[model samples]
Target chain A: MKKRAVAYLFILPAALVLGIFMFYPLAYSFMISFTQWDLSATRTYVGLSNYRALIVSPDFWNSVLYTVYYVLGVLPVSLVIGLGLALLLRDSSMRGVGFFRTIYFMPVVTSPIAAAMGFSWIFHTQLGYANHLIDSFGGEPVNWLTNYNGIFQLLFDRFGVELPRVLQGPSVALTVIILLGIWQNIGYATVVYLAGLQGIPQTYYEAARIDGANWGKSFRRITLPLLSPTTLFLLVMFTILSFQVFGPVQVMTPQGGPLQTTSVIVFRLYQQAFAFYRFGYASAMAFLAFSMILIITLMQLKYIERRVHYD
Target chain B: MTKRHVTLAIKYAVLAAGAIIMLFPFYWALSTSFKELRDIYFEPYGMFPTNPTFSNYISVFSKAPFGRYLLNSLVVAAGTTFLQLVTACLSAYAFARMRFRGREIIFFLFLATMMIPQQILMIPQYLVVMRLGMGDTYQGLILPYAATAVSIFFLRQFFRTIPKDFEDAAIIDGCGPLRILRYVFIPLSKPALATISIFVFMWSWNNYFWPLLIVDSTEMRTIQLGLALFRTEGGIQWGEFMAGTVISTLPILILYFIAQKQFVKGITLTGMKG
Candidate 1:
């Protein structure tokens, strides 16, 4: 009875918070999505128009393609670098391990908006540091941000080849946003991976080594499998985060400009909601985006949960 | 022993390189903040300033009502953290040691809410906030913001792990739930509370979007919105922006440094899994 009392008391605030902020907003957003209500002007019910626009709109599809491309550009490399750092730091015998971990996690604590500004300045072609470095190497300062037509063209260029401009998925301005996203979040995923590394027992490593397993072999066969759960968690998180990305696009690609190639879905949603005050239209868009995220993340949740191995 | 040394050497070298790259951007942000405008741009990679000036910092405050913004943010952050911890503690204790009907279902339902993005709810939440007539008020800022599902849930989870006998003993001595919590659970849960409070404080301080929607007047602007005003202000003064970032980021950075041990421990313990 006493324990029951304590338990009820304990869950009360979190329950209240979840009820008011999260649960209410969720149900209310769904309701808002169904109605043509922007709240700034008079709201009216126009069921399914919002959902219909999702399938028909070219911009919506393009945003979807661009978001997927951005995820590819950032999330995979983020996992690799993060996992690499976690592996690198796991040897507790190493000196200054704590300090290294601290420095690595610092970026996670810093504001993304501020970091976006820094990256924007760094990537500026004319007077930017990147251009300065290129000049020092006797190379021409190529327009990194302006020249990319879309994703396909961008891929060809990376392979030191050229493609027709039509094949590209995202613009140069948007690519910078993607790269900066990876850089900022790699630290975060790395910290999470480091904690996950704690679950692995040292005896396994020693036994593997005694059996004449090389470092690469141990990492591939043992570490990789063990770290799958963490990787899955990170993948789901990154996918959701990718879909809702706004800040970098806001700062770096102000109108998601350079031919609207950088304009992501969330940025578009913000423009419609706040800037245009087309709350009803924006609400429709918001809900559509929300639904897409929900479906995708739900799929991910199912996929990852099955593979998750608890040690 | 020799193999161990080799592995350790490799670990240090790789970790050191990654750490340097990770920290370089922040170092540059701080260095540029102190730099004279000409040096920052003309020699972009220059790690040190030829001439440092406090003028940028002065301009950040003088050109805008930054002091007011900082105070506004501090009040909101402090108030939210205070209330969140109190409510979270009460609720956490209820879930931890208390026998309750529908405990598992209610708790799981609450946890399920965490998986959804807050963006989905923006319009409706805004409408609710507007309807409440709490716009531009501290009560508006503090009350709505205090619904910290993460903290309360985390606290509740922590409370469950603790042995129930301490509370039982205290109760047998005629202590009430609140008193038992005051003398017993509070002491043991200090680390968890500190961790939760710091994050809640940081979240409240750095939150821009929701506040931007609700906070109508310039005076009510938190530091984040105040800093973002640079986005629309006089020149897109990159120098001033760096300066402003440096100034605003310092207090939190300093606090984080002081509390880093607890912060890291908290994250490692609560953030890794359930």
Candidate 2:
């Protein structure tokens, strides 16, 4: 009984905090999602109207589309570049490898808001370094943040082809935000990939070499297969992180950029709850975004589980 | 041998280029922070500042309540880190050592809370905090994050790895559970504790969204929120803005430089275990 008392005492503080802050709030959020609370005394139960409105709202759908564009734009490109960087720096015997690793990981530790500020300055259209560089190359300056045209549509237009609205890619402004996401994530992916690379036994490569495997052949046979778990981990992680991206969007394009093209789900939710004081509606959006993320994560885990080799 | 040397050279070249690209933004921010407004807007701008100045950094403080923001951020980050460490240590010890009733079920419950992302809870949490009269207060900022499932789960895993002999010897020496945790577990688990501490501190420091939600007054703003607001309010004061970025980032950058190993280990541990 004394031992049990001690155990309960040990767990009490954390359990209390989590109960009040996390679990209770979770339940409360679910309840509020069905109501018409606007930070007023009255919270009338509305019964699925919030969700119904979200389903049909073009703004909500646009936010979802932009989020998908941000995710698709950031994920594959970062993975490829991260893998490339990991391979380049894999041999620790090389001088300055640790230095290179530190440099790459610097942005990972950086505050997203701060990094976004730096990026905004760098890509600031007229007086930014990017435009300066373009000017030096005798190329026309691109409107990075203010441009609302979809990049793919722009490309297609140059060839006199009109792409469908849904087929248009992320807007130039959203693409800039995606670039920031990719920049911040590549370091983390590289670090994780480096750890994964280390776990593969040195003998695997030696044996492959003895079997007359070339660099590309051995990499395809040995490296890629073994890195699948790490790849899966990064995929799920980046998806979740990118999906929750709000800081950069808020910083670079405070009003969600031109035409609200850069407004992600979380940003839209923020606007609804705080800016518009529609707590119940925002709660519904939150649940929807959460369900979408949960579904995507579970799907990834299930799809990747069969191929993940424990050995 | 020449071919191997050539490949080695190519690898170095590629690495060097990547390093430059990675470090350029920071370099530019730092360089721009030191340049005068005229130099910042000068045509055919020089790569390096012609004449470095500390005036922009000085103006960053003078133009806003940046010093107060720094103090607020310090208090919140330190308070949050201290509370998280206490809660995580106690619960981790209980989950790892104590065989109480409903132990596995409770542990699983705590783990399940990890899936409840902060976004879903923010609205209700805001209401709860405001109802409790904690809005724009340090408690509102610190208390909600007092017990994270990640820290508890992390420290529990760390505690389970420790040898049983130490606890056994402590028990034989008339040490109570609290004493064992204080003397045996904490003393022996410095590196793991350090890892968690650095991560939580950095996370708390960089957190912007929560503060944005709770804090309404400038006096209560954190460095991140302050820097962001500074960008909007300052409006094209790029020099001062860069200076603010530098100031806001300096503490974490310094911490990272001092404890790079812990930062890296934290990432790997969380990445793999999570």
Q: TM-score: which candidate is best?
A: 2
Q: What TM-score, to 2 decimals, does candidate 2 have? A: 0.98
List residue ranges in candidate 2 displaced over 4 A.
B234-236, B271-274
Question: On residues A73-177, what C-alpha lDDT tens digit does candidate 2 reach at each position?
Answer: 999999999999999999999898999999999998899999999999999887899888888899999999999999999989979999999789999999989
Error of 1 at B41 (Å): 4.7
Candidate 2 chain B: worst-modelled 10 consecutive residues by lDDT: B265-274
**Relative to the unseen true structure, what is the C-alpha lDDT of residue A41 in candidate 2, on a scale of 0 to 100?**
88
Question: How much is A236 displaced in model 2, in angstroms?
Answer: 0.8
DockQ of every model listed? 0.51, 0.66
What's the TM-score of candidate 1 when only chain A is evaluated?
A: 0.87
lDDT of each: 0.74, 0.91
TM-score per candidate: 0.91, 0.98
RMSD of each: 3.2, 1.5
Scanning candidate 1 chain A in windows of ten residues, the lowest lDDT window is A163-172
